[model samples]
Target: MSKNNKISALSEKDGVNKPEILSSQVAKHIQAFRKKEILATELIEKIIAGDKVALSRAITLIESTNNNHLEKANAVINGCLPFANKSVRIGITGVPGVGKSTFIEAFGKHLTGLGKKVAVLAIDPSSTLSHGSILGDKTRMEELVKDENAFIRPSASGESLGGVARKTREAIILCEACGFDTIIIETVGVGQSETAVHSMVDFFLLLKIAGAGDELQGIKRGIMEMADAVVINKADGDNIQKAKMAKVEFNRALHFFPPKSSGWQPKVTTCSAVTTDGIAAVYDLILEYISHTTTSGYFDAKREEQNQYWMLETINEQLKNSFYNHPEIIKQLELVKQQVLNHEISPFSGAQLLLEAFKKKT
Candidate 1:
């Protein structure tokens, strides 16, 4: 069936007229956004305006696969951009039970108490595999989420690696547009591949447990090397000395590696996110790094580089989607897969045939 026919048939099966229904839904969202009734801009605007509800909804819209909602969602984001603050973007990762959520809640509350608008976006990797997210961070962040100045969003990874959600980059933009002065991205800490979060965030923070004698083994060199700051958590009570010792080891280890970006030294610090001790110092360290980088013009340059990376990623995603969506290409995929599996042809040759078939369809 033709694309239009397929859409029509799908719409019919769902008991609705496809084109008209989609158009109406899109129009309704647009109107709701503009009329101040729905406040599509306010969702993110509230986030920037220090409204938590707006922030949550804005994230939900961005993560939605509803094709009709995308255009207007993009529009709302664009409109909110001007009012948004150029906030500090921090990526936080650590092993499970390292009190990541607790640390964020305490840390977020600390920042907001200092009159900073904090936006928390948690990347829930478990959600991707299970197709359901507990949104545990928001629940764990009880006080912070309730604060009018704080916005908390928990997103499923959706087949992305290192617990980084696919729409996270766009979500960051929306959070920024909403005037969130501080944006924190929390990724599930499992593999060494947490570098994906490092690519987009300005500051990469690796949180580790105190007394994990084999600290080096816990965090891979690749991720440790990318870190802007290494934080030792659970620094209260008996763990305090261990945390301090871990800091010393990390600091020494960092000395052997060259700086990640020019003119900025990645520091190692200790904090008990549970007790809120040393959390403020962690924030201060980030500010110090940002100040030094901005003074050296490295901040602006890094953002430009990140923009280029996003452009490439967007192009790659679109091409993959378009190729797989083509009628002829879809029909040819199984045959190519079998041929490649059976070693009847080289993978490259199979790819070439698929490309040729796609070109013919066009």
Candidate 2:
């Protein structure tokens, strides 16, 4: 090839201007916002004023493991408490591939369209080996993420059991205080996490796909019992008929269970996330349950019970963290673990020894 005549394929040329994902105005705003350290009081004020950025920062503080952040995080949470509990908390769960992300987006968009502020706290499962998660729920919920009335936060499950983030309950308080009247907590799917999520949310929704053999599976008894609504998602097109069948089966299955304490019967519905079919009915169902419970005064009573449960849970959690983080326990845990593994000591005995050591450390 002649040097001048032959154009080099590898040579770089100025490409057409690529559109900025974030505009210059947004970039500058973000820069200006990040330049100053917001105090707890300012963060609480901003969050109460419905500033999404401040809400996010407060949530970050809540999720942080650093000791220095704990006090401020608590301060912000305490400040938010008076404004919290004004929202309806919904817990959603289903198996993988059940179109949870899609359903949540559709449901969230529906709520926002009604002028209700929505916040989605999505829990992404962490890898057992690397302890990392994709936290891609925000990306999946593109339209909802862009809605000014909606806030979507994807958090890693980390070592927390039950497919929920450790600080999810705290996050809920912050979301409610931030003026999000509808809080949707999406679990990591159906597991022990559902129990945690159930205790925290006012309404528990179980999302399922049609013909998944869930109709006959008694293994889901616990989750089914906890579910205030069993929604068959992906109920459009070819799956419509199957979804109807599943709904019937689920309704029958729900009959086998006793009535909920809230004096509300569980509902079975079918929806398609793609077409957004039957999404509004789900919200209506939630409202009905809320009204029914509120009228009976079970709503506030249940929240009080949950508060007590979480207070004890927090104590247990703090004790566990303190025991593990104690210098003496940290030094001996591995040795005791190795001894148990080598059969030099019984696991129960090793645990007792560790507890004793922790006691002395304290």
Candidate 3:
């Protein structure tokens, strides 16, 4: 058959259809399982049926930038809200050579051995600049990656703040929905701004190296203020004493910062990701933080605050997109830029004019 005939035949088989509804009401209904309007058992069955394509599609729905997808995503999150609180969210960050992947591999193995399921979502900042990610963490975490109780997802950060990916927060929700007890977000440990990860996770951990003296350069007040615990990697072998020294420095530094949301002092420890020494201590510290916060009601409060923050962020993102998509605003933006460049007005004035034009249109 000719190409036109083939297309016609397929179109006839499918019948005529209207453009898709941006709000995706059908998707919202599918996500209503969390409200008891749908069955949780059936949801779990769908997730665990080894349907890789379905899982990927579900993740895309949750990560979507479209306003309609946002509503559907919220419905899905609400449905899983009750079952989601059981998991512990931990944020782990460190410099390039601090062995974050190795530590997570060993730590995850330890957790699974204790009959717990672990989920690791690592965000590689380099992916944004290079448009490629090493994704080496999965290879380094060979054992954990293969374990049935473990799920490792390496995502491209793509210009996101704090070397954290955009969909990480949503991915955490999905992992909780799937019944994972531990969710670990690994971020590229650049410096101060990395605290964005702290806002999302329950426990915020900072990984350091022994005697990197670069600690003085990277350990700003902002990072220390958010950290719940600081771990010095490569503590085994000859690096042990140096790691101990680094831990002391970090401990002293922590004294100047205020307490974290959990109202507990962030502890400092040294560990060898290679030998897995002190990994259990790190896990123990996380549990202690969780216990303290939960008992004090801070855990619930923090989650509430996080939700509010997410809502505000969503609103800002949507407004920015809407402004750029507005035809009148786009036309005025070019004129405004030209005006500014010709020194006819300051950039701020040009922006004001654009805003005025936009408001008039709406």
Q: Which candidate's TM-score is highest?
A: 2
Total backbone collisions, model 2:
1
Q: For residues 53-170, write the lDDT of model 3, one tens digit per residue.
A: 3344556666666766666666666665565667899998877888889989999999999999888988876554566767677888999989988888787776667567777777
lDDT of 1 by residue, 1-362 (tens): 78755564335344655465457788998888666545565565465564555666777776776656767677767777676538788999888888889989888888988999888889886554467766677778889989988888888777666667878888887788666888999988887438778878888898888776666553447777788888898999988988888888888888878655557788988998778889999989998998898998988898889889988987887677678878999899999999999999999999999999998888
**Candidate that beats the other on lDDT, 1 or 2, i.e. the better one:** 2
TM-score of each: 0.82, 0.89, 0.80
lDDT of 3: 0.78
What are the runs in model 1 whose C-alpha is more than 4 Å off? 1-54, 66-68, 127-130, 216-220
The residue pairs that clash in candidate 3, if any, are: 34-79
Candidate 3 ranges beyond 4 A from true positions: 1-45, 48-53, 66-72, 126-134, 215-220
Best by lDDT: 2
Return model 1's CA RMSD, one decimal: 10.6
